[model samples]
Target: MAQVHLLANRKGGVGKSLISLNMGAVCADTAGARPDGRPSVAVASADPQGTSLWRAARLADQPFDVLDISGDVANVALLKSLPYDHIWVDTPGWAEITPEEYAAGKDPLGDEKYGTLLSALLDQADDVVVPILTEPDSFEPTWQTIEWVLKPRNVPFVVVINNWPPAEGIAYVEGTRAFCEGHGWPVARTVIRRYRVHTNATKVVTQYHNNRVELQAREDFFRFALEHGMRTAAAKEVVS
Candidate 1:
């Protein structure tokens, strides 16, 4: 069975899709062929916007299979049967409705369809990756999702600070890390810095390890995957 990873956060514009694609690329690139000769990595997008699917389509040669399983009960069910080592699911940018809300029919997100799909994904996921921005505005919703949704389900998770500005100095980065640690949250030591390479990723088929200029970004993501248990021993051996 594939280990399902959900890239999720209630906060919008937190780089969830970007991180999902990059990590999927890394898994596809490093994991090699499976015992059955199937691809090692696959990506399933549950986002209504289908951004990941669109990006995958634009690539000249897709490294791995990308599936648009948004709001489809049958497609979501098909995830368990996929013959891959790692399966990454990209979820929408809203917090899932609580059971209380669902029972009460409050439907805070305005649709039971989305909440149901998200709930199913969370239930099936082996690990969750919460991408958060460095700004103060992103802090509240990030913690809220972790506390209200992920923690309640006892899901294992790690917070990655995305789009960190290089000029902000070590003090800013350390402060964010300290804050998360103080709250007893696991935070990735590797911070993905702001770069044009990442911003332009959607328009091209560049992997993190492809260009010399993207070496730092590549290392950051590679370390993040290793620390978060996303990479296999064989992948780590190749990196080392």
Candidate 2:
């Protein structure tokens, strides 16, 4: 059975899609093939925007299969039947559904019109990756998602500080790390710095293995993966 990993955060602009695409590609590249010789990794896009799907389409040859499991609760069930070792889900940024909206019969999954689809996806996820920026506004939603959703479900998760500023932002990063640690949340030791390469990565088919300009970003991701136990499956073979 495939382990489903969700890249989720209620706040936008936190590098969720970027992390999802790269992590999914890396998982596909590193995963051992199935007994039938088929690749053992795939990605599912639950985001209504379809950004990950668009990027996958742009690639001449994708590292792994990409499924646009958007809009319907049935799609989430469909993903469970796929034969893959690892399935990464790229979820939308809006995760919080206000009581007023719920009472008004408005869905939090947005205009996609899929009621409770996000909840269904979360139910299927084995693990969740939360990308957070080191700012007050971003931190608020990230914390809420963790406290209200993940914690309640007893799901394992790691908070990754993405697009961190360089030297000048060191203090802010430290503060954020301390805050998470104090709250008993698992925060990745690896911090991804702001880089031009990451910003422009969506324009082309790129992964950590093929990226040249921002090698550190790739390194950071690798470290994060290692910390999260994702490297234990085939780390040596993947690195070699």
Candidate 3:
């Protein structure tokens, strides 16, 4: 079965794009890096900004290819026809959008365009991964999304806390933990602490905040992949 991972969040500035491309790069590396005969791994970018495409271009030397999911009538049809080992979906930030505006822009569902993309993704996916920010305002929207995705959809998903600041006081992290635990959210054991490296790193380049390469950040992501059982050590070959 194909592994469809959605790098989604209802709110923007939550690092959805960063996680999506990183996950796609990792998955592509895991699948042996080549596009042909190799396991297919593509990023179905639904954002107008084309952040994923830019990132993919930056890493064009890598084995895999990044396909743009242009806002065409055939977009969904094309996605449905793809045969890949994993499809990493970079969804739009829609919590700030009005309901009507979002619905008009989506597929059949009364959601964002990414919602239509999500519908197609869920059809082919066995798992979905959501990135949630630790801020309180963002937390409510994240949960709202969880409720929506869970309704009548049996696809399994896990939530990762992004942009986590260590000096934000213990109450913040504890609050997030308690909220996830109380609401049955599958929070990952390793929290991605807010590092300058993470903030400074671009899509293709490996620069970090402290003027160093953040290999540890990549390792943390590898661990996430392992815990989720999405990929194993074999996938690491694509990175080199």
Best by TM-score: 1
lDDT of 1 by residue, 142-191 (tens): 87678777887887788888889888887777877777788798887789
In order of TM-score, best first, we have 1, 2, 3
Q: Which one wins by TM-score: 2 or 3?
A: 2
Taken over the whole model, the C-alpha lDDT of each candidate is 0.77, 0.75, 0.64
Clashes of each: 0, 0, 6
Where model 1 places Cα greater than 4 Å from the true spot, the runs are 35-38, 95-111, 202-211, 230-240
Ranking by lDDT: 1, 2, 3
Q: Return whichever of 2 and 3 wins on lDDT.
A: 2
Q: Each prediction's TM-score against the native? A: 0.84, 0.82, 0.76
RMSD of each: 4.9, 5.3, 6.3
Deviation of model 3 at 12, angstroms: 1.4
Tens-digit lDDT track for model 2 on 45-150?
Answer: 8888887887777766677778877866766865666899888888877656776875696644565443366688888887899898888788878887787668
Off by over 4 Å in 3: 34-39, 60-63, 70-81, 95-115, 169-171, 201-213, 230-240
